[model samples]
Target: MPRLLLVDDEPSQLKALQRTLRGLCPDLHMDLALGGEEALTHLRARAHDAILADLRMPGMDGLTLLGQAARWQPLAVPMLLTGVADFATAQRALNETGIFRYLTKPWEPELLRAHVCAALAEFQHRVTQQTQAAAWQAEQGVLSPQELERLRLEREEPGLTHVEWADDGAVLMPALDAHLPSMPR
Candidate 1:
């Protein structure tokens, strides 16, 4: 079962959402917070698979809270809900904060449930990938200094093609001689 946190300043709105989500997602363990501060408190106590927050609030807004949540719990998927449909705010939330979804107010219960389920699935996928990568790293011991340097260079220069090490530890790369810019030959 996935854990979720929902934050809103309005008590009535929070209660309504809570009741609806609980009915829709009976398997999900949901927690409600009155404001951003209380949300942060709940976040610090335990990790949640997803967080849904209202964009407008008194002290700490949803965007700010999401940012904090990202730093505190990178695995958790963050989402924003706002009454107004502001493109600029939505863009910022998607680009800067990496919000999973931006939902407008008066949301349909089914749509909200679908978005929450998708976010939970995504979070689970990420966690599984991280675990697999860690296991692979453990099986394959640390890379050589030369290989590490090559990897660093490859990351720095996106134009470079992929490179792999052979069984004998030889570096192999695609033939880029013909693709190179013409020289004054």
Candidate 2:
């Protein structure tokens, strides 16, 4: 299940956010924090797919919290929900924190829900892309002789070290040649 963390100094605001989300997404798992410290504690305990924080908290503003959240959960989508509509703060949040969305106070429930859904989708996409890239890298890279031998042994039987190498640091697998028809010597 996708998880979300919502941080706000006001308990009522947190409740409203949770209510809006629950109405939109019944299956979403949400964790609420009253402050940045509480939010960090929740982050350390479990992984969340998205984080939405208030911009002006008593201590540890949303930008700072989101920046730290990024360090802890690099893949988590960070979002800012602030009453202040300062352009400089928005720009800083985008550039420094890499927030997926910046929403102002008195947010529309439907739009907020849509943004959360989009954030969750973005998180899933990032994870899928990372997995695919890693898999492609593994397939394209040359495996060392020891790794090849291990794979061969695991596939067939133990004590089967069929990996061969030339003196010039090139891999020469004898098994591959054995599969080919005999050529004129």
Candidates in order have lDDT scores of 0.81, 0.82
* Top candidate by TM-score: 2
Name the TM-score of candidate 2. Answer: 0.75
Q: Which regions in candidate 2 have their CA more than 4 angstroms from the true location? A: 142-185
What are the per-residue Cα lDDT tens digits for candidate 2 across 33-150? Answer: 9889888778766778899999999989899999988866777899999998889999999999989999998999889989999999998897787556555655777555556545
Deviating ranges (above 4 Å) for candidate 1:
143-185
Per-residue alpha-carbon lDDT of candidate 1 for residues 1-185, written as tens digits (9 for 90 to 100):
78899999999999888877875555888989988888877776667889999999999999999998886677789999999988999999998889999999999988998998899999889777765655565568655556555544533332243446789999976456533333686
Q: Cα deviation in Å at residue 2, candidate 1?
A: 1.1
lDDT of 1 at 131: 57
Model 2, residue 20: what's the lDDT? 87
- The top-ranked prediction according to lDDT is 2
Q: Candidate 2's C-alpha lDDT?
A: 0.82
Model 1 residue pairs with clashes = none
Candidate 1: what lDDT? 0.81
